[model samples]
Target: MKQLLLVFTILFSPSFSAQKTETFKIKKYQIAILGDSLKESSGLNFFNGKLYTFNDSGNSAELFQISLDSAKIQKKLNTKLRNEDWESLTNDGENFYIGDFGNNLGSRKDLKIYKIPFRDSLVLDSTKTISFYYPEQKDFTPKNLNNDFDGEAMIFLNGKIHIFTKEWKSKETTHYIINPENFENQAAEKIETFKTDFVVTDASYFEDKLYLIGYTKLAKVYLIVFKKSENDTFFRETPKKYYLGSAFSLSQIEGIAVNKDGIYISGEEFHSPLGIKKGQFFFIPFSDFD
Candidate 1:
């Protein structure tokens, strides 16, 4: 698989400019095995003072509030929306945005994000839809993990919604922007690309720092911390990269969320050749990485 050539691919990626990336192993972490109710937790977020997450596609349209101290489900917020492929969860200090655009096959044309209202620490049933399509993806051919339009991470920044693509073939991510003011069907303008040598599954922005986490096809997991550029950019500068062990060791790590306290990482229920499988939750403080 191309993921095996992560080091070489980072330096010679033909589609994007090549850059050298060195990874460090994060030594300290706290792990928690979540219950089966959150076995497919695909996204993590903090609403008001509570942490929340939800299952991926084929699951019910409900949001689960998690305990930051124990990583247990505390509450459930029911909704009428269909869970097509909820991949990322984020909030803009007011409303919560759930990215329902997980295109693993890369042939999906009905990509959209659900903007739900969060009032008094609860998500209201009435939600708004933000529909979008990539301008460069003219062909809707079923490429199945080979296409570039697939996405799983997004954030509400600068009054606009920014999405990061999970490039299955190139091992890179492209930042796309969707203006929220434009209500009707809009084009997600591609802005920039970075050869991360991994498929980004989720992203979180906090206090001018952007945290992007994903795993390679070879099951190598990574955490990238990108500082805010001077020009109000998120991916212009080189980021601090850390190799957070392997998915085989931590299941298929997928979701991430950051705040003043520390970082929260989540993984879905996975079965590996090692015959060990379960959803994983990790808590790593800011001091450990320093």
Candidate 2:
């Protein structure tokens, strides 16, 4: 009887693992090698047909514009504002928003987004500040990067700024919204909550589609695409998720931008018990997924 049970376990274990495992292949191409200043490039966006990115915590408040042909920094936009953990970037045709709310520990009270009026050039002096807080969070204690209130990805949608939280404790994402016109320190409206099981690093919206990029605790990278749903709400429809790759090959992916050409991704240099990698820039053609 014991031998029979062991044989059953051996025969069924592989099937069980296969049943639980879901993965999608992505065709990736190397774009460039990011510089030291952008070793922690945590946010990415495309403005005026140019790709831009910036470093996250412990870095300067500067935005680097990269040339697609050469895949090198062509210009750097300097801001007088402090970079207190800027984590995401978004734009609304005429203006740009920089999210300064990387509360990994969930103890932050000064969460804000800087809005810069833009047309022909990037302006830093004429920027406005939009502040917000979660209405559901009552605790101000630091939890050491394992909290639900932590957020690093956001995008502009339907006249409002939608923020996606990088949940560490629950592995779920909470959707929130803030009015761009209202800059007062008000409570963000909770839209909905869903299980992502990965930390969202950056988000982008284009052509009525939502694109999000993130990584797992084990360094597995993923991309989630949400098509337009009823009334234009992202949660009303099921999302299509695709596995990008592993950190051993891609490092700590932290940024994503999708356009007519393809999907662009960047990662910060990573050094862990598993492996070490440098800051990288990569692209995956839409044909591979579409």
Per-prediction TM-score: 0.89, 0.89
For model 2 the local lDDT of residue 93 reads: 80
What are the clashing pairs of model 2?
none
TM-score for model 1? 0.89
Model 2: lowest-lDDT 10 consecutive positions = 1-10
For model 2, state the Cα shift of residue 89 in Å. Answer: 0.3
Local distance difference test, candidate 2: 0.78
Which lDDT tens digits does candidate 1 get at residues 1-290? 11122334433545433245455544246468878898888889887777889998988888899898778888888867899988888888788888889888888888998888887545565678889999988888898778888898988788888899999878889989888666688999888888888889899888898889987756678888888776457788788887787776676777888888889898887665455568788888877655
Write model 2 residue lDDT over 126-209, tens digit each, in one string: 899999999999998999656899888999877889999988777777889899988799799998876776778889888989
Q: Total clashing residue pairs per candidate?
A: 0, 0
**Whole-structure CA lDDT of model 1:** 0.80
List the lowest-lDDT window of 10 residues for candidate 1.
1-10
